[model samples]
Target: MTDTGMTAPEPTAIDETRQRELQILSEDAVLKGHPHGDEQCKNCLYYLDVDEAISYCWHPKLRVLVGQDWYCQWWEEITAEA
Candidate 1:
């Protein structure tokens, strides 16, 4: 997979409006901004960078912009074939 130098989003960088529009999960709900063991958005199968500090979660249930370090219950490890 292509690397886009993804990083965590700044606190003010998150688009609250867009987040609400998409009904993105709350940080608490998704366990975001915290790593689950070695799992994170940057290493998940659904993550796609939108910019250096922002990415899109392509998971059907998410489909929201996320930070590289964000983690969710749906987090899936990216395989070599992905």
Candidate 2:
């Protein structure tokens, strides 16, 4: 049998397509420069990446995509990811 350890199964064609669509992006959106990086997104008073494009106080529901580096004044780092 071939060595499975060396080469993991690649994502299915459909899974690959979906992942490409789900990956972080900054299109027609702002790449916010967070003073706290991940800290901000995770600790914002209202943090949620649901179906809607979220923000500290702006961003309409499902109107825009959030940049991974986006941040606002209402940011905090409660955990390592934040």
Candidate 3:
């Protein structure tokens, strides 16, 4: 018997507007240079380089986009927020 575990579909609607929004998010909250008092968005679980837009987060692969700043649920902290 094949064990076919149900899985959430990948995100697909990540268009230019979405990308821009997320980019703004990263710039505002993630890259605000808050002093590194906490983790930056770059190191979070949702954080992905511009090259790997096709990649999907294991926890909640539903919400996706090219850039990493795209917010979701499975995000993790790498360092304190600046």
- RMSD to native, candidate 2: 9.5
Q: Kindly report which residue stretches of model 1 are placed more than 4 angstroms away from their true locations once superposed.
A: 1-24, 27-29
Q: Candidate 3: misplaced stretches above 4 Å?
A: 1-42, 46-51, 60-66, 79-82
Off by over 4 Å in 2: 1-7, 24-39, 48-82
Best by lDDT: 1
TM-scores of the models, in the given order? Answer: 0.61, 0.32, 0.26
Give candidate 1's TM-score. Answer: 0.61
Spell out the clash pairs found in candidate 3.
34-82, 35-82, 36-82, 37-82, 38-79, 38-80, 38-81, 39-79, 39-80, 39-81
lDDT of 3 by residue, 1-82 (tens): 6668977676566776777886775554433422243443345655555256445434343333333434433456654552
As a whole number from 0 to 100, the lDDT of residue 61 in candidate 2 is 27
Task: List model 1 lDDT by residue over 1-82, tens digit each.
Answer: 7778998566553576766645545643465677788988888898887354668888887777788887889988788998
lDDT of 2 at 63: 31
Worst 10 residues of 1 by lDDT: 21-30
lDDT per prediction? 0.75, 0.46, 0.47
